[model samples]
Target: MFRLVVFVASLAVATTTAAHFPWLYVADDSEPRLFFGEGLDHREYHLPDAVAGAEVWQEAIDAPALRLEMEPLEEEGFLGLAASQQIEPRGFLRTTIDYGNYHGSRLIYDAQHFPAENPEAWPEPVLAPEGLSATLRVEGDQLVVVILHSGAKPLTGAKVTLSNAEGGPGLSAATDDNGSTRFSRAAMIDGLNGLMVMHVDKRATGEISGKGYASTTRILTATFNYRSREAAKVSALQPLPQAVASFGAAVSEGQLYVYGGHIGQAHDHSRENLSGYFGRISLDGGGWESLPAGPPLQGLPLVAHEGQLYRVGGLDARNASGEEEDLHSVDQFARFDPGTGRWTDLQPLPGPRSSHNAAVLNGILYVVGGWALAGDSDGEWQAGAIAYDLCSTDAAWITLPEPPFKRRALAVSHVDGQLAVLCGMTEEAQLSKQVFFYNPASRSWSEGPDFPGSAFGGFGLSAWNLDGKLYAGGMEGVLYRLAEDRSEWEKVDEFQTKRFFHQLVPDGRGGLFAVAGASPTAGHTGSIERLDLVFAAPTARR
Candidate 1:
């Protein structure tokens, strides 16, 4: 009876051990022993499994259902079961021989253990491709690789390797004596996307003595589109020379004619050498052309009456005593015909004088305030203004009202038969701002508006009838326009440069052509500039 009890106790202990430790079959011949802890509820029993098999069959049941297989009347301890053909129940054991143990044995299913399903919890590290430098640029349609070496001597016969983004075919070249290699028309993918990569390698001699080094490997990736190509077009006009003569002159037919007054050499000296030169610029030929030396006169003032140009009295050359003298002691006048291009003597001014102003009104030439004698040292400037009617077969000078101011170099222009004398220099050689008007019908002088600025020596004063308004320019290039009532002077546009002793000729296109002014600094310049006369729109009175 004690022996029987020992056998039963051993059987119970063996069954409990088998329930805690299940046999895991990797293959038919391979069975790995495994322990089932608190959470382990299933065991996979694989069939026809080799040691290297990837998968296994599994069967899960309650721990109490495990059974121990043993011989009759045998005491059961821990059993190490092995595959054997003589084992009953087809190599599997159960507690009962009914459908419960059979159904549990057939519960086997496949379970795969492939690298633990690659742990989806952690992120993997990605490395950029190796073997290239970073300095690269797009040249034309290719990726241009430039390697700068740190050396004093030029690199020669050094090899360079270039590779594309993919580990595909690469190119190699030898550096020239300049340590540079050029790859022309090489195909490269557009760098707009982040997929493209380039590699460059270069070998160069170092600046240190006898040491040769290669450039660090460079890697380049495409980041942006290349710049587009541009086509190639002409380049504005140059400036013209400044004026060198007088202003307030006239242009008739095709010739721009200027007359009267000497442009002083400098402010330190006077410009009293009234032996002035007459100049003409040909509009058709496009330049200034002066006539050969003509008869010397004082003031050298000119007026156009009936297609004839009349030059009035002016001083001859300076005398031995360094004083100006009247050479041809007559109120000498010379007439030039545009058709004949010749000069004929005309009846001179009634009085001999220099520094007088002239204007033609109704076929008559008016001459005003100049020195009476050739060498008058007594401040003998006259206010007497006179007129010569060319309509008379024998045109002779007739006296009119005197000018309001004793001045010289005063520019005069005729508008609607009215003579307008602008600013001029006083006998003291100071600029005068006073202006005067003379009505040919009334034969009287009246005060006009004051000039805007002080007039200087070499005043190239000019006046023109532009849209029924009188426009004038002075020595300092200040242009002024008189209002319709002639009561006020309005400053207009100034010239680009200071113009004195220049001729302002009516352009006949509602503009004036300025020509030949002596620059105070640059001396004589024969440049011509045009001034377009613009009329203002009429405004209502306030």
Candidate 2:
């Protein structure tokens, strides 16, 4: 009985000691938690005491007695603590560490335990301006400078000084409200020989701290050539030669061959009122020549098909008694062969019409939407559209599909194997900006985007396919390029001047030549202008 009592006393002491110990859990490199030795006192803890049993509950009671709540000894292998010391708490962590030696490994910490704070100050360096640019014009020896400040606010009250390579006396000026400065006698500076350099002083202050202030200097080159406004005005005042209207103009091999559009008094006394003449001008050479007068017609010649120019359906005779009769009751069609420089009669059109639009598609000439005379009165507008095949000279003119809208004086050009009709006058003689595209293959019409500005009236409309894109020029002196996807139209550039009744001929290079346009301001300019399309360069971003 005494021996049993001693054993029970020994087991009770052992249980009391185990109840005072606290459990320890260590995490492996993979963050898997593992059991370690329990401890009533931290110094008595041992790693090998780790086991899977109910001792975990006994250690929980001893946690406060061992002071296990103290921060782990982050050094040595104590409870799997790392050997490195705990990092000092910095204001904020930065990501600018050099990863070249470390092979891209990042230093990470438990963000929850170490919450970041607002930085007392930013350690990053401040950036400076890249470069300075200026545009200047010289009048005689004096220079006028125009500086562009692209900053958020205007740089007012800045000082600008000029110097040359030799560093001699240069002009100085204070910037005005608009950030512009001009020197009265910049030419008086002796050292400012060929190249002049201007210096700008910009003063900036810190907004937040009031402790930092910065002053930057920028240099600009002022080498420029200038002309006086008086000289430009004098050149503009020079008179231009007058242009006389003569007809038989043919566009041959991309050149305009012009013939007579003139009528003169008859030489015989009896036939004093009857006179007709014709002349031609080559757009390449800019000279006029005469063509034999065909039966008199009071109409303009139309050129269709690649090689043939036609004069079809015109009033034949004029009477001396102040009355005129349409003698050419039947349609008359004359074809001029540019290869041989001769005229031949072809099969006439089915109906007599005037002021019509003609377009050639797939080797067929389509005459569209014109006016026909009702009685002896003036001609009435007609909505009929006709087509003729040039391959069969004797083939009668056949009625093809008509336009969705009846319009006269409209300009039509072939675009992407389709005919695009531009702005023209309606039967009421009012201009319209309605644009339409007709597909000859599908025999369908689709509406296109309207013009940006007002409809161009009596203006030459032409389209050319360049680099797989279509460009059209109108009377407003604006050239528009069609988006390749046919979604929208963009205004590309403006012509040198506004003109009406002009002709646009593509140069076959990616440009266009404007010819024979009547300028309302200049009065029938015979001058030709060429437009070369330019594109903007792509910009680089930092």
Candidate 3:
């Protein structure tokens, strides 16, 4: 008699029989036939002599009886079912069979049909598939692969392998009890890093937050499979002309331009904050050179827009009107012409702000959260956002909605078509890991993924987009990579030291320019470094 037993949580029993692990298969035709025990589940479902019983049921919208009857089989290693009527287009089949010596060895299966048109139209799974899954992520020049089971349980002692996407030899890792294991990205192949979990344990299951991935209903399979086709690694590049920190830097005409800031030994703050120097570094290996100087400014927002380098507000403690003329902040605005070597003043900002971040798109510039000086109270960060369109003749600062939260010293860059704001200091003076993406077309702000490792930003906030990938590093001394297609940031490589206040510009030659910055012990380093691209290739193919 057909029966449905109550599911007791504590009595949950899993099966990963080394002898027979059943799998269901279907043809690639419009009207396909079903089969069992063929591909990876080779030894799982061997047909037994005098078969006990096999039954099939399909999810349906309109059916008299969803249960199915078996057709007489001439095939040796296949299971066939004859349904009475049409099945739902988005439907799947659930099967149970007894064909082994093990008592009560009933296997349940939920297999989805391919060629699904819409995700919303897909039917829910009748039974969950028990398998392995993993993700290969960039972690400090290493590719760490996190492994999990079908129920989001981490599998310890599981054997995993990585190979070229097309097919080749591979690398192996035995998972730890925490279900955590790592691989090196520098050893990964150029194409896709194809990963497969080789664990065969049935008693492994764990609780996981459902937010990370959608239900594996449509993509259900007996074995877990994943691919991180594109990965990144950071390496040392060229050093800077001199040790500079807390300065204004920008990239124009494939060159990096800098403004005044503190020039100290390493990451030391003892350096004088009074320099009116300006310089630029060429991509042709010409190195750094002095440019016409402007008003000594530091902690100012700079950007390259419409062939002109523009400067936003700044903090002016180094002014020479005696010490009394020093101001905590100023609402100054100007644009520099590299040709004439002069800056033309423009309308000042809506307010006095510094240590902020900005991005330019289509001749319009957007400046986000930053700290503002108060006459009496300590400077507090502001949530205000403003924009200006230089393309318009009567362009004026326009106020927009507040950003994700109040913060300052952030790395903001334009990626793919969105403005991504990352790193910063929170109100509590903690490293901020919140990521926000602003869509210009929709005029909307959405939350992105938090950085993989630690929070970063502050006076050290510096980042840029190059080679179709967003590269961010500083303060935290860890270089992060985020491609347009990825929602989360990956820890690609680590800097030589705990550096901050550095400038990052794409070299356009498959590398990046690491300008001067400050390190904890090094004080200030004029040592500019270049990070060439690195990748992991397959050691052997299996």
Candidate 4:
């Protein structure tokens, strides 16, 4: 006895329990197998001719797509076809199975299989052949799932279920308007295979296999390999010798060196709070070893090249703690030789400048975005940029064409022959997210993408270039990298602690080291945090 019931929008239900889903199991250096099952617990059912005969396609990131040859799977626990060739570890396997009609409705299943390697290495399919599909991305400790329909359209309100390969009813969530949802990567079950099953039931009359049906239901499943592993790790290292902000820091000979900074509370200035402390720590983990101290300075820039560190102009406070403070910028330019353990004076700046940032580009040092702080009076903003040839013995500060804006406390980075001056406090003392780029080759200034954060996120931001890629972060605590096309900034990851006026240096192992700063939660902290990009071990077959 079969009856057709009218299905409405509000009463849509998943076929998780009522119907079986097509699963594609792909392992590294192994043949891919296709099977029909109910969740992770395998089931053996007579294969439908339409589904068993469907073609499987292999799409690689760097190669052309190819049709795979398959043979019958006569195993007891699995009933389907196994590809004759082993799949490459860097691509995906996909196929469409038309399950004919059942229970007065037509059923179609689309499935995709992903390897357990780096998510960045995964190739995006040209189409949502599964009718319903999902893409996964990692942000810190969270796993984001984006559900899409045909033509890569975001499917709003789609119901998705997540389950472990071992077996369980699993957890279900509804996608938002963006057709995405987040799950704690730490809380998910670790195994060789994980399932994100999505179900959508559409109302329409349809005929399949000469059987009349009043509706169609499409099943989409994204079978991912998961393990409880840290894709990117953030851990607290040993705190600095003293908590300070506006400090000069650089890395030389695999050691992190810190020079001078302000040890006072935010917005508080005095000679007593100014620190002349200098120290170095092994990046591989060790206590900070003290070095001969420098002048009690702040608002300076420190850069390293060829195993030597360069400390540029900075401001030094002379008065005692109070409203009556004497602050003047210095024109002193010097370099520190780690091998000789001494500082050598270099040619000074054209004029005293503090709060500016500096970077090394092709054996040249470029300084931009700052002003001259004279006495207790307001600082004089400068729109000009200056550079010095580090490779020449007659090095001198050469003034370049004036820039468009005057700012301080920004971050500068050189990548692909361009010097980028990122967010800072403007002459009006307003925080901004604007970013300006100077092309040394063309001697022209253009604008890059504005940083991602609040208006205050730009002030006191920090940036570093590692192997041609630029990374920046600030008050938001979220790290961003310049897109490959250089058109925009894409988020890389996020940490819990948020602080501005801090510094980010390379960890020397493809990560970053966040040093002391004025934190909103902990106030002035000497804490050091380390972030590393890591990947989980290859997921083995269950």
Candidate 5:
């Protein structure tokens, strides 16, 4: 019994000692550093000579790895590293150390430094470093850490802990089958945050450098400095060339393109109020450049795929200002090439449609939820959707299975490889909050979470999948981000101006642009609002 008690006490010591793992620190325009610590406690005396002496290297996308110079910064409580070459965004600093046997087991530490100050600047296909390591990334409003073993194999069920520099009880979660855990950025204390995970292989009993061990513990840590205390701000950009609503807008190759829309009073369609103006502007900032005008249209959406803009059927006003409104939906599907500076006609939509939105997935353009407005007649609601293969030699409209309900002025976007049709107007002319999901692979439809907003705010809702996350906005001015599980949308931030019939496009800088739409108070709004994901730096815990 005494021997067993002693063994249990040794195991407890091993676990307690393992809590102090190696961490790497990276900051903007600053030299990266290494430290041995636990949570918010930086242990200067615990810095191991093996950790300090380990060779360090920095790696980046499309760049060769370069060795870094190490300097002992005992006064600062960390070991500083200097890179001979500049480490680009998404690049990381890594070091490995064999801690040798301690408390009846062997401990190995692998540390990585990732840039987290500006998530927008981080490049993709974040290559995970060799050995047991974790990669940090931002999805919507959550910070995700994916732990891996043997470079690519996911380490499942590993307990991961996150601690902010402010300290307190940090968040802890277990890795899923995908080796990933998401921490709510809203709940996490801003500033420098450290994530650590460990894997214990009792079967890994072996000798390291003649130091025998009862087991092996691999501890991995990824550290990043971020600020998220500032509330997301909404600022106006250069306004559109004209105040318009029900227009079509898309972003292609870093440029914003807008097409025809109604320029008159809401719901009043006349040839005089129809806008045939087409223009483009660099998202980086510049005055809008006028392009050759196309047919005057309204209630349509523009989608971008492979650096080109596409438009399907739209409602066109035929009557002059004085005559009775003569409205008709046209089946003129076309593509606009920025290089050629002209629109090319493609196979028209299956039938005339208007007030519809579209999304592109896997090179296929899907048009959803609209209606046919014939002259002096009630609009015919379209219950089905259509798809066009952009990559095919002979691209044409392919009718999809009909959805259960008919909606107009709806928003369509692809998320998680499925198409999500958001709120709009139903056949009864009632604003709807219902949402539906369609799986192209299964060619079936599934009901999704209803829009949380009131029915009045559902009309002219806009949704887009940006950076693999779905975001939506409506007349309510509330911006919502879909939960990672597709369960529901949690409130993100709100727009300073509540508007509808606008487009939400990526600002090409890890932000979003709420383009021209009709405002409740501002009438036809031509203003452009930008939303950026910036973490407000919180005050240090008093």
Candidate 6:
């Protein structure tokens, strides 16, 4: 009886230690060996014996050859041989890992390896276990969720939470006798509504800590078939005439407009008079043409709206040679019409500022957060937000409530009737990942998601929106795509030349123009580039 008691104690200890998440990874030192361990860094984690019953199946993704029948590496830890896989002309090697309850589940994405000659429908996860499962369906304007215990039995009255994944308001519910609940349209963040998660936790059967010896946590994630067909493709463009930083750019009437910026690379300013030129390039591979110079401005915000281009608050001139007059934080606003090629003065902003961000939602323009001059010193960062009715003949600015925090040099994108302010520098001269969103309809500001794996305070940090998703980058020359559910940031593609201030303007064909930014070591690059998302399939609901 004593020997049996000791054996039970050891078993209990093993189960407790193995309660952490199981991570599946490919061993690089060997022939792509599959290893199921405790964390994403599998070297530091091994598969717990309690949930070691793992399998790799791609049959649901229709890639039978990519499925590998897993076997333990040495009697127990779930390491197995990588299957000699083959890719379809245009599909995924979507393998689902079944590591029992303790390991939950994982989906291995092998999409990049198989560049489809004719990429078509996106294959999704169809097979999974029910130890804890979630079923997602869109009914009317609501998303219905049903929690399951073993893929079939309802998990009644359990606590469930629903997260949009894009860093916004989350919802909570209690499952009914049918293990079902719903989140109305009001509970969801608007946009492409990417992958969402339904999580369940309760004192049900198992305990990561106690005698039940079963995993009490289960998550059901549904991909609801929102598909993106773009490969983060990037290419170099025609080099700029000279290096420039802190410039403004806009796309207007088939022409790419570039505004004034300094020649000096960020902090290493030479005070040279060579910069401060304005120009534009044709979308049809045309050369840059020197245009009528607006105010010799740098660090200004330029935007195109209603067939007109506008330049907002920025430093109009520098104290070059400590002699030339400088417009430290100019508040002047003007509109340039490409139709008539004429400049028109508009109502100036309430105050002078620089490094602020703007976005057009519906027909209104919003200017948010920046820095102003205070007693000849760069002032503290501002947390203000304001809106202007571009269509309103009044031309007066309406003051909105301030953001939750102060920021500068951040990026903002208006999508699906909402705007997300991205990462940027703080008043403390430090990088920040703080994000916030504004709803024009409700006129409310709320906290958003942090910039994923990125510091906001990079010299060239910027933000833009594409297809209801957010993209921020250039601080480190790596572009990150924000998932709608905001669960994680997708590092779509990296640029060969790391640069800040490079512009990403949509090309009207599911791609954008990436051009004219300064590289830290390479000075300024006029080199232009194209980043085609490559995916062109119409999004369909599952």
Question: Which digits, one per residue and each the tens of the lDDT, describe model 3 over residues 132-224?
Answer: 444333445565655665657777776655543233345667888877777775555443233444432233322233322212211112221
Per-prediction TM-score to the true structure, in the order listed? 0.48, 0.46, 0.52, 0.56, 0.56, 0.53
Tens-digit per-residue lDDT, 176-283, candidate 2:
776566655434332212122222333422222233323222222222112232111111111112221112233556554432222321111111222244444443
Local distance difference test, per candidate? 0.44, 0.42, 0.55, 0.73, 0.74, 0.55
Q: All candidates: CA RMSD in angstroms?
A: 42.0, 33.6, 21.8, 20.5, 20.2, 21.6
Question: What range of 10 consecutive residues in model 4 has the weakest lDDT sum?
Answer: 1-10
Model 1 ranges off by over 4 Å: 1-249, 259-264, 267-279, 284-293, 296-298, 319-330, 376-379, 428-430, 455-460, 520-523, 535-542
Q: Give the residue spans of candidate 3 off by over 4 A.
A: 1-241, 265-271, 318-327, 374-377, 456-459, 534-542
Q: Which prediction has more favorable TM-score, 3 or 6?
A: 6
RMSD of candidate 2 to the truth, in angstroms, is 33.6
Top candidate (lDDT): 5
Range of the 10 consecutive residues with the lowest summed lDDT in candidate 2: 109-118
Q: Which ranges of candidate 6 are over 4 A from the true structure?
A: 1-237, 268-274, 322-327, 456-459, 535-542
Per-residue error (Å), model 3, residue 342: 1.5
Better of 1 and 6 by lDDT: 6
lDDT for each residue of candidate 4 in 1-542, tens digit (9 for 90 to 100):
11011111222444433455667876344788777666655646556676678788876422357788977877677678888786554457788777767667676778887753334333456575347767776656777888788668788886666765667456667789998987777556655454454444555567876888766666676776664432334333456766688888888888989888888556677787788988899887768888876688898988888898899999889888776878999988998888787888898888889999999999999999888988967988868899998889887788887888888999999777889889899888898788888998889988877787687777888998877878788887777778766778877666445667788898888788877666544345555666553431222110
How does candidate 3 fare on TM-score?
0.52
* lDDT tens digits by residue: candidate 6, 1-542: 00111111212344534323332322322122344322222223355543345444432221134454445554243343344443222222223333333443221111111112111122222434544545554444555666665547777876555433244434567789998887775564432232222233333444333333332333332222221212113232334555566778887788788887766424533235336677787776557787777677676778888888888877645565446344467788888877677888899988987878787777788898788864457575666788788888877888887778777777777655788887777777887876777887897887765665546324457677777766666757666776666555666655544567667676656666666666543445554555555642322111
Off by over 4 Å in 2: 1-250, 259-286, 293-301, 304-306, 312-330, 373-378, 456-469, 508-510, 534-542
